[model samples]
Target: MNRKIIITGTTCTGKTTLGKKLAKEFLIKQIDLDDIHFLSNWIEKENTAFVKDVNSEIEKHLEWIVTGSYQTLLKDTVWQEGTLIVWLDYPLNLILRRYFIRTYRRVFLKERCCGENYETLKSTFSSESLFLWIFKTYWHRKRRMHHWKNTLFSHKEWLILKHPKEEQKLRNLLYDN
Candidate 1:
């Protein structure tokens, strides 16, 4: 397809996995916002810098699968330009469970994303735990995505993949092309 796709969802909804798969199938670049927005020691980049970097990256490619929920920095730009937006609207329990498990594994294994390692339990539990962020923002994110679907992004090919089966079906459909 010629569309510039964006796969977005709350934390732990498999946006990265699906984005990677779709990008590979389409031979388009995949831009994981986390990698660009986060710095070493798990610190976030400044808003201005993040926006500039994201816009620069977006400019470098004709087609891309941009994945993340960086609403403050990139939402308008991404939505305005994206041809397709895929929202993974999974159930809350599923997302929370996945978030917990993924955080647990990453913490235990000391997994790093883009060279930024997570902090200790004290730091994580205090104010930086992704799990906590998930719990805090899940409903808000759901509502926002729903509203966007009905309003700003209505004309876009907005696909709501709510389950693994549906995700797989879409994957197969896209891959077959």
Candidate 2:
């Protein structure tokens, strides 16, 4: 398809899963920004360096699916070049539930996430916890995406999948092509 796709949303919105599935189906490269933005030691990459590296990597591929909410890092490059922007606008409660489950698995089961970061009770309960982060940013993210949908990215091809049925329809449509 040679499509440059971006799947973005707040934490725990299934961006990575959808990106992986689409990339696999289309035989294109897939990148999760978190994987390249955070180091193994959990230190974040410098903003300039992160932007440069991500831009370089994406520029190397003609077709790619990049999943993450890094508008600051990618706006001029990947985001601008995207053929389709998939915004997952799930409900706040659903996002909270998903985040809780994901964090629980990571913290209790010691599951590794992007950047090789693992969740711990101490960390999960701390201000840095994904759960707390989601609570703080979910509404803000939704508002931002809504703004983009109406103004900034209005002319671009976009999909706002708010429910499982819509997501399934999107999947079917993509797979059909």
Candidate 3:
């Protein structure tokens, strides 16, 4: 398809899932920022290094579905170059519900994260929990994406997917190739 796609949104919005599906269907590479951003024990790669590596990796591929919300880290470079920017604007309640279920499974089932970090029951219920983080950032992220789409990425192509119930609609929009 010769597409350079960026699938982004707040947590549990299916950005990574859609990216993987598209990449597999198209036989193109898929890049998840989480994979490049974190290390063992959930430690972060240095900001400079992470940005460099991500940009370098993106530059090497002609077709890819890049998923993540690290827009500031990328300096708008990827957004400016993307063929399509998919923003999954799901409801907060839905996101929270999904996050809770995912985290619960991770804690009890020993599901490993992108960095090979496992969630602990203690951590899952803590103030530092990803659930809390997502709760706090959901609205902010939606606002920011809106602003960027109109401002920083005004000229780029965009696909704003909202509400998961619109399954056939989403498929139709995405399969427009």
How do these models rank on TM-score, best leading? 2, 3, 1
Model 2 global lDDT (CA atoms, 0 to 1): 0.83
What TM-score does candidate 2 reach?
A: 0.92
| Model 1, TM vs. native | 0.89
Where does candidate 2 stray beyond 4 Å?
none
Q: For residues 80-143, could you state the per-residue lDDT of candidate 1 as single tens digits?
A: 8888788888998888788777767676877665436564666657776777788898999999
Score every model by TM-score: 0.89, 0.92, 0.92
Please report the candidate that would top lDDT against the real structure.
2
What's the CA RMSD for each of the models?
A: 2.0, 1.6, 1.7
Misplaced by over 4 Å in model 3 are 167-174
Evaluation by lDDT, superior candidate among 2 and 3: 2
lDDT, candidates in the order shown: 0.80, 0.83, 0.82
lDDT of 3 by residue, 1-177 (tens): 568888888988877777787778767799999989999888899999998888899889888789988987774577767888888898888888888888877888888877578889888779988888897888898888999889888788887878766535545765786
